[model samples]
Target: MDILHIVGQQRLEGTVSISGSKQSAIPCLAAALLTDQTVVLEGVPEIGDVATMIEILETLGAVVTRQGDMVTIDPSRVESMPLTGAETRKLRGSIYLMSVLAARFKQGVVGLPGGYAIGPRPIDLHIKALERLGVSVRNEQGVHYMRVDRLVGNRIYLDLPSFGATISALLVAVFAEGTTVIENAAYDPEVIDVSTMLTNMGASVKGAGTDEIRIKGVSQLSGCRHTLIPDRMEAGTFLTMGAALGRVTVDNVIPLHLESVIQKLERYGALIEATDDSVTATFQEAKPVDIRVFHYGGFPSDLQPVISAALLQAKGASIVVDKLYPQRFRHVQELRRLNARITHEDASIIIRGGETLLGTEIEAPDPRGGAALVLAGLLASGETTLHHAEVLDQSYERFDQKLKELGALVWRETI
Candidate 1:
């Protein structure tokens, strides 16, 4: 395993360029399977989950070539095969393939998805939406087998606006025989990016970044080139890091995507300036504030952990409510190791700040949790050792490198 060692209380100063959206790029890779032509994707993040997705693509017979942040996927030579359950277990993004494969090959098998074990992200919504689209889905043991004789578009309502389910529905409905309407769809920028990619590929998709999505299905989809948007979560992470350390100017970011985070951070007394494509955050002091994580246009649940780290030095009491993932407070125990005063009740985490954090060895339960640990280390008084820190690769590429660029003393040590 690899451990990350950080010498805390160091001021961070420099401009860091945000990478492309890992969330958006994963679905785009799966959507490439919807066509038989060559699809070129630019601005794809070089993250571990993406590499795993590319491996899944190649395993299923797609000719994939990568250079820097660009990936060319040739699906003309693709073949229908049961995706390896073990491989699918490596990434929760692999569930995006269920809809693509069912639409393309009429039948496929995928195992229970895995990624950050933040909470139980059940695929019931995905299954329900797919069943509404005339697909027969069954779970045998832990694997899901889905088949469709012919997909007929219909209105599908989601119980909640799940980003994964919305993207999965779009993938499945892109090539259906008629129109498909998705109500209470995810209003995430990533969803809009996928919709835009499908539109560029000649699919009629509208109402992305809104609660309701309308998709006029087509008989076929052609390949096209699309550039991914910058990752807002990564931008938020850096911003939170800035709140704990010193100043961080994030480049290559779409300011609009960071509206919720910027609003919250500013409310908590962090100095933030946003331009068209960049955001600069300078921390003065941490202020206690209550945060509620919601769907898009709200504080992202993905950013809950990092922000929690930022709240460690808050003046008073702070409460974090994560409705999306109730068990997202996995970092609480690890942060406690750094002497953070935090407690939880159900889905809410209460943080009492004003404690001087002393660094100690801790473990990262997941990617976001790992990031929170790193942030805690940034504010702590001594050396912090984070175990299982390599999990950051799942979403972030060159995270340690980026932090080092910002003047943080971070290094990877294999143990």
Candidate 2:
């Protein structure tokens, strides 16, 4: 396994460019299958997940070409095949393939998706919504098989506003018989980006950034060029890193997408200034903050771990509740290994701040939690050695290199 080593208590200063959204890129790449024409996506981040998605696309017989941050896919040659293989099974993003394939071909086969197990994300909602669109689904062992003679649009309501399920619904509805209304849909920026892409592909989609999304089914979709939005999660992680020390300017970010994070960091004594496309964060004498992870346009669940690590240096007590995924506190235990004063109680993690962390051996289990461990190492006194640190590559592109550019004393080693 590869390990990451970091020497702490160093001030971070410099400008770091945030990458394109992994969340947006995955679904958009899957959207390429909705059409047989050429689809060009710009600002695609070069990450492990993107690589996996590309591998799946190629296996499905799509022609993929890359240039710098741009990726062009010719899905005209795509053929429906069982999305079974080591690389295909390991991607949670593979679930997005289910709807696209089902829409393009009459039937689709896929196995259980793989990724860092943050918690249980049951696809019952996805199955339920697809059934509403006249698709029959069955599970054999760990694989899912779906077939439809022809899809007819219907009003579907998600029990919870899940981003993945919402995107799946949109993909399926694009080629359905009539109009489809999605109630309690996810209002994520990624969701909006998908809707915009579909619209660009000559589909009628409206109210994407709202709880209710309406999609008018069309006969066929034509591919178009689209640019992905900046990654808000990456920008938020950098902001949290800045809260520990020094001034760091994060460029190529959408300020509105980071509203909740910027507001929360300000409450923790971090000075944040946002322009239309960039944000600058500076550390100060931090104070504890209480936060609860919620849906999009609220405190983001994906960022809970990084903000929790920032709260470690705060004065007094801070409480964080992960209403979205209770199991997200895995980093609390890893932070404990570094002598952080944190405890888990039920759905919430209570953090008593003002504890000087001492670097020690830790583990990076998942992408977001892995990022939290890296942030903790930046504040610790001694050397912090993180095992399974390669997990960060799943979503983040050039994370260690970007941190090093900002003057972080970090390095990766194969061991």
Candidate 3:
């Protein structure tokens, strides 16, 4: 495993253009398998999960050419095959391939997904949605096999608004026989991005940024080039880092997508300015404030940990409630290893400020959590060693280089 050695007590100030959304890119790559034309994807992030998707596509016989940040997929030579269990177990986004394979071949097999050990992320919602669309789903030998002789659209109501389930349904419903209505769907920006990609590919999809989505079955989908929306999560993470260290402006980002995060930062007394495609966050002198995190349409649960790290340098105690993944506070213990005053009780974390963090060796529990650890290390005193630093490759593209460019004393040391 690779480790990152970061020297702290430096202000990160620069214009950093965030990478493409990894959450959006993986689903778009899987959806590319629905058509047998040359699909060119621009602004794709060079991440481990994206690399896994490319490997999965190539295993199914698609000709994939990756040059710089552009990925070209030629699916004319793709053959119908089940994704291996080992490959499927590497990333949660692999489950989205089930819908893509079902749409193209009408039969697909995928194993249970395994990513971060955050919490119980079951695919029951996905299976139920697929079954509603006239697809036969079965769990055999730890693999999910889905077969549908003919996909007929119907009224599908999700028990919960799961992003993965919503995207899966959209991918399969585009080629169904009739109109498919998704009730209580996820309205995240990534969902809208996938819907936008589908619409650009000649599929009729509407109500992307709302709780309900409707898709009209198309006989076929054509090849189209679309640039992915900037990663809101990445932008939020960087903004939180800036709020912790110094004033920084994150460019090439869609500010509208970050309203929830921006509002939360403002509530915590950070000066945030938003434009059409960029957001600048400045913290002249950080003041501690209490915050309550909610679900989507509110403050996202992903930003809670990063925000917690920033609050460590504040003036008061801040309480963060994580309603989505309660166990995401595992990184709190790791952060405390660096002399942060954070204590977890139930689903909320109490962060007391005015403690100087001392750098120490820590492991990245997950992707987002690992990012929080890295940001804390950047602002800590002395040298900080982060194990399992490769976890950042799942999202951020060239994180070390970017941090170095922004005046962070970070370097990659292979062991």
- Candidate 1 lDDT by residue in tens digits, 212-268: 999988888999999999999999999888866889999999999899999888988
Clashes of each: 0, 0, 0
User: For model 2, where is the 10-residue window of minimal lDDT?
Assistant: 111-120
Query: How close is each model in CA RMSD to the real structure?
Result: 1.0, 1.0, 1.3
Q: What TM-score does structure 3 among the candidates reach?
A: 0.97
Q: After superposing candidate 2, which stretches have Cα over 4 Å from the reference?
A: none
Clashing pairs in 2: none
Query: Tens digit of lDDT per residue, candidate 2, span 236-346?
Result: 999889877789889999899999999999999989988888899999778999999899878998899999999999979999998678888888899999888888987
Which model is ahead, 1 or 3, in terms of lDDT?
A: 1
138-172 in candidate 3: lDDT tens per residue?
89877988899899988889988989999989998
TM, every model: 0.98, 0.98, 0.97
Clashing pairs in 3: none
Give the runs in model 3 whose Cα sits over 4 Å from its true position.
none
For model 1 the TM-score comes to 0.98
Q: Which parts of model 1 have CA positions greater than 4 angstroms off?
A: none
